[model samples]
Target: MGNHDELICAFLLSGDKPGRELSWQEVQDWTPDQGNIWVHFDCTHPGTGDWLRAESSIAPYVLEGLLADETRPRCDSYDEGALIILRGVNLNPDARPEDMVSIRVWADSSRVITTRLRRLMAVDDIRNQMPTGKGPATPGQFLAKLAGRLIDRMGPVIDTLSDQTSELEEALIGSEEESNLEDMRHKLNELRRVAIALRRYISPQKEALRRLNHLDEDWMEEEVQGPMLEVVDRITRINEELEEIRERASVIQDELANRLAQRMGGTMYLLTLVATIIMPLSFVTGLLGINVGGIPGSENPWAFAIVCAMMAAVGIGMFMLFKKMKWLTIPK
Candidate 1:
């Protein structure tokens, strides 16, 4: 059942019947009985089922395998239910690579099925909360638990990003170091990408949950609705926060770039000014060094000193002119 290509689905029987995990063969052989809920995972064809279906190709294991290196977050819905996909952020405060984990889940009234290519904190958090004695009564409740866990996991990640951004902003104010700017740009871009991916899923998930709230199915119990609504509200709030973070990151990036460009422009301006002042002196020296016998300064020993004095005077005069023209700025 743990085979890479094997699919495993478990069913929790209703009433007082004992819960049993069934393999695909056992599920196919069993007769349909009332109060019995079935869970099936088909490794070869996830698309062949009725009521609920998840293609192995789209199953979490398979999808994770295919998109292991994919970092983008997204959300989509299918005929069976809704697919909420998102990237979970790594919140290590140390400067580490920003690795994002992708989550894909399908949910309906009777069952919630999840697929992922990698282990994500949100999934593990919910799994840890599952009761040892009993499984959730319906798929919708399971989904609510998962969503709530996801929102909970997001808090620390967002807080970490916010802190890092604030620190970068302060650094920008005090230091002229380009490294700080570069790091800020890199982090901001990564944050923006993650936010965009989250938006892709969180936005649609809000609507999906709204639809679920009004669904015609009797399988959704009153006990689960409260939690489900709470999950939806949490998701909406998180989405808003992510959007705000994205906007702030964008502004910071732009400001950093502009500051860098200004510094570069100032340095270039100084270089150009120095070159302008040196041009006349270079011409004088070159003219004096010519091979011709009639060169103006070559005949006199004191001529070299005179020319040096003239060059110094010219440089000073030009510096004063530039100062008067207000071309130089005081370093802040």
Candidate 2:
């Protein structure tokens, strides 16, 4: 491909057996009379918008969608062609899975063009399969296959979130260490954030896929409906799983908070009990230590011993009274 050709790869499918790659010149010269074609483009490339706006014979709305800066999952029909915008979990290096990448598509009976800003592994997987002569033969099959691949990649990421949530729940239940609790709390919050973000896009993407499955496209026939429905079902399952993970994470957080509150209440009760026992002893000592002329224990050495013994007795009595009142047991 030339620098002026943003085409990452273009396949001129001869009944699913991919022929030689098409250049920008060839793509521009191509037409529906030349069998089915699939063109993949990097929309961030400067040449892409120029070629799409000037050369491609797609509708104005479809062209706008292909070059859209941001879009949610949706499908719009125009004549026999369908314009679709879908999002997949970001799998790029150093990227969070929740930062989903968007793919825009314009598919008709004979051509399918897809564009994206970030590299999608699902797109690569299908592109790779074409070399083996074992890829989708028609535009409908290609759309179904692409949807399947996008949803398939989400399985591992969603499962990882679930596993992390489970681990956090177990840790919260089995451990009382402050540092460990903090770590688990942090992980839980991160998991929830990831799940929420994933669901944010995946939910709409699911609806979009469902719409595609039901779309009245001449290229997408009864033969393609089964696979398209399967893709829709897969997306539904993924969204349901994300919902479960989010709820479980929330439960773990609440449980952790309750446990911490109970621990704190017990600690505060014990401190209060200690203060209660010392208060009277402090008052008694202060009263007996006065050096005024008529102070009770000032003259006699025996009086000092008596005062000390009495203070000790009062301390013991207060402790015993607290024990009887069950104040030291600490409420749960």
lDDT scores in order: 0.60, 0.86
Worst 10 residues of 2 by lDDT: 12-21
Clashing pairs in 2: none
| Number of the top lDDT candidate | 2
Per-model TM-score, in order, reads 0.71, 0.91
TM-score of 2: 0.91
Please list the Cα RMSD from the true structure of every candidate, rounded to 1 decimal place: 5.8, 2.3
Q: Model 1's lDDT to the true fold?
A: 0.60
**Best candidate, TM-score-wise?**
2
Q: How far is candidate 1 from the true structure (C-alpha RMSD, Å)?
A: 5.8
* Tens-digit lDDT track of model 2 for 1-332: 66755789998865447555688778878888887889999999888888788777777767889998988999888895999999888999999989999999999999899999999999999888887777887888889889989988989998888888888877777897778877887887788888888888998898899899999878997898998888898889999999899888879888889877888898899889888888988888787667677887577889978977888898899889878987779866
- lDDT of residue 15 for candidate 1: 25
Which pairs of residues collide in model 1?
60-115, 60-116, 64-117, 111-139
